[model samples]
Target: MDLKKILWDFFFLLFETGSHSAGSLLRQSPQPRHTLHAGPRLSASASSKELLMKLRRNTGYSFVNCKKALETCGGDLKQAEIWLHKQAQKEGWSKAAKLQGRKTKEGLIGLLQEGNTTVLVEVNCETDFVSRNLKFQQLVQQVALGTMMYCQSLKDQLSTYSKGFLNSSELSGLPAGPDRDGSLKDQLALAIGKLGENMTLKRAAWVKVPSGFYVGSYVHGAMQSPSLHNLVLGKYGALVICETSEQKTNLEDIGRRLGQHVVGMAPLSVGSLDDEPGGEAETKMLSQPYLLDPSITLGQYVQPQGVSVVDFVRFECGEGEEAAETE
Candidate 1:
């Protein structure tokens, strides 16, 4: 309390009194009725919700992740999308590493045929629910297609190769992604991130038909995809290579039935029907009875139809120990 302090305090006191009087008069005169006003906070909230929905639909990310991205980017759609992709990829890699050891015992077998070559891929997930997801199915189809292209590039060398087996590591470098701009592994990581589940490209195999032979395939329990018509997805699938004297068009029915027979009968080899009457015949494709008309053996069914089952491969989801035993 100096004299200067006292003077300053008095000056502020006088100013406060004048402002109070003005406010009182202003309040008394503010009586406007039926005035319309837009709430800024409500508008902002609605916009945020719309933005979140758009981000979710465009990115196929979780709502929680979408909202967080929007908030982190301050409601910017493009920036949020970039942030989500980066974050999701990072998270996906982390999740995939952590879940790598988990047994992926459920999934689908995807089959795709291009001309005389056909590829079958098995993609495994943790649960059936995740396996049935459209994204997961799309992943399988993409992997199959990518593997087909990879094999096609080796067409010249494949002439001598009976069949080619592709492990995950081999396919990891193949091109994938929505725009075919990323590696297969990156696409897989993204899927794992979005689905929040352990997924693996367990195994893929491709068979190329030799000259004078035709290939036919069937997929049991298949569900048609909205986008891909050439690809078939199901729990069980098979491809049969037949050397037929009949026209390719005429062999279509027998070829498809042979495929079904291989899948349904689970033959170990295309043993000659005359190998013996015992184990060889029992486990031979030709010796097995036709599924459509069980009264006749497959050899008799196709022999009269001018079809000879040259070779076949079958795939079943989660076959595990039973599959090994059969092999």
Candidate 2:
């Protein structure tokens, strides 16, 4: 049918339906009450406000982006959320690529212990401010947990006396997220997008406590994680492996104190007083003065209690390769 005829017929049918007579239409004002636009203006309608707020609350996205997603998905909240995640992932990778070469000298050291094995991970970013962010902290914690799981998966290939280290490239491919179904690189990319910083998973270390020994851990400048359990974030962290002749003693407490000493004193190697001579002993874990009791060397303090230090791992944020060699 012709356009004009179709419009006329539509109007005729409307009049015939008797909402308003043709004479009544003529009696209406000459101009329309609402101004007409060439196209629909993007807006949050009253009916969609509830949906918009729900989407914002659930996704933690900005109001403007949530509104756009809702509009793009025709106000279907589920579809809108999925759309937002996809867009964020897409934008995250793009941002990560652009910022890949920027220096990341500030971040957190994450510590996690599972059974006899302990894991420490250093995840770096562009600034200390991002280090304190909850999302960034969560990412670091998840990476540490993933590092533990990754090391555990390789247990059969390693010896009891062995220590495992995973560099940046190897860490990027591991599983991350709460369920650990997502790639670590993708998780990091999402964080880089949201936090607007270049980040890298610099390194991870795994150590297993041998039979009759325990691993003790501590974090300097430590704070309890807001989301994850048994995970701590800090500027410096340490894990100490200890062997004790007295099995009835409080070994955990001793191990923790040793860890604190390691974090605070920054020991270079796990040397005994017999092995390190003169000034060299100052940098050895056992020969140095214990941080909590400076009058006593760590060896002097623990030996009477039948505890002997075996091995340790210490991580400081933004430390160079020279410092990493101590691990």
Candidate 3:
């Protein structure tokens, strides 16, 4: 055998004999040591636990629920939220269903206007506290903005530019979601699950005026300042579209005043008592005394200004419930 082979054989023989020299050499060489105590593994585990805690805080779900949701979604935050919402709906639906009969007398009216187009939305919650929540306000704003933009885009395709109401089915068809991958209904469901309360997009309306007309909006009980043409009314809101015969007139100012009038008067229509639809006592907008004067009728107040009311929408929180109870 070669010298190297002989050396290797001698080394093994010494190792088998438990020679001190061979054992010392073997000890000198690096060998991986197995440890029962965790070091890096513990750190990794701690990071995961921290992440789980963070998700629980954000979602308002319990630790075990959050952990299970994260695991089910492969640690994806967005998917985990979706999963949690699904679970909430499955588990909480029976309880939530019982709440359907409960009156949602608290809510905020969100208004958005872009050019001659304006959108109004009423989102109702079970309590006033939820109405004041920033998240709920944001949801209202998003829904109003989305509705305004969507309606404006559809102006040419649809014959009428005004829709007085949007049912749940219609709302479900509107574009919504973080990626616009879903509808407003989906977002509402997610919010309902997260908030642990009953919520509804009670109503929505959109109005688009012609070039000679202008749309303005007013919000009462606003928690924040208005942005652009949008208004975040804390509880009540109004939208008014005014048409001017002369292009030189300041239509924006007139529209704003009209909107304020609508908000104050809670007008139902723009015509006189003769023109009233004769359904509800409060539906006669033109017959209502002028909010500013309280002497002249609203129709008379506007007739002298060379401006005509094109459309108007007034939304008061819990108004529907009041109407329902009366009926």
Instruction: Write one digit per residue (lDDT tens) for candidate 2, span 289-313.
Output: 7788887788877777777777888
Residue 45, model 1: lDDT of: 83
Candidate 2 weakest lDDT stretch, 10 residues: 35-44
lDDT of 2 at 247: 74
Please, what is the TM-score per model?
0.77, 0.78, 0.69
lDDT tens digits by residue: candidate 3, 186-295? 66765666566787777777777666666667777766623333455657777776667687456667666777787776665566435533322555676676677766
lDDT of each: 0.80, 0.80, 0.69
| Residue pairs with backbone overlap in model 1 | none
Could you say which candidate leads in TM-score? 2
True-structure lDDT of candidate 2: 0.80
**Candidate 2: residue pairs that collide:** none
**Candidates by lDDT, descending order:** 2, 1, 3
lDDT of 1 by residue, 212-276 (tens): 67887888999875488988899998888777554766676777788898888888888785754
What C-alpha RMSD separates each model from the true structure? Answer: 6.7, 8.6, 10.8
Name model 2 segments beyond 4 Å from true. Answer: 1-47, 155-162, 245-249, 321-327
Clashes of 2: 0
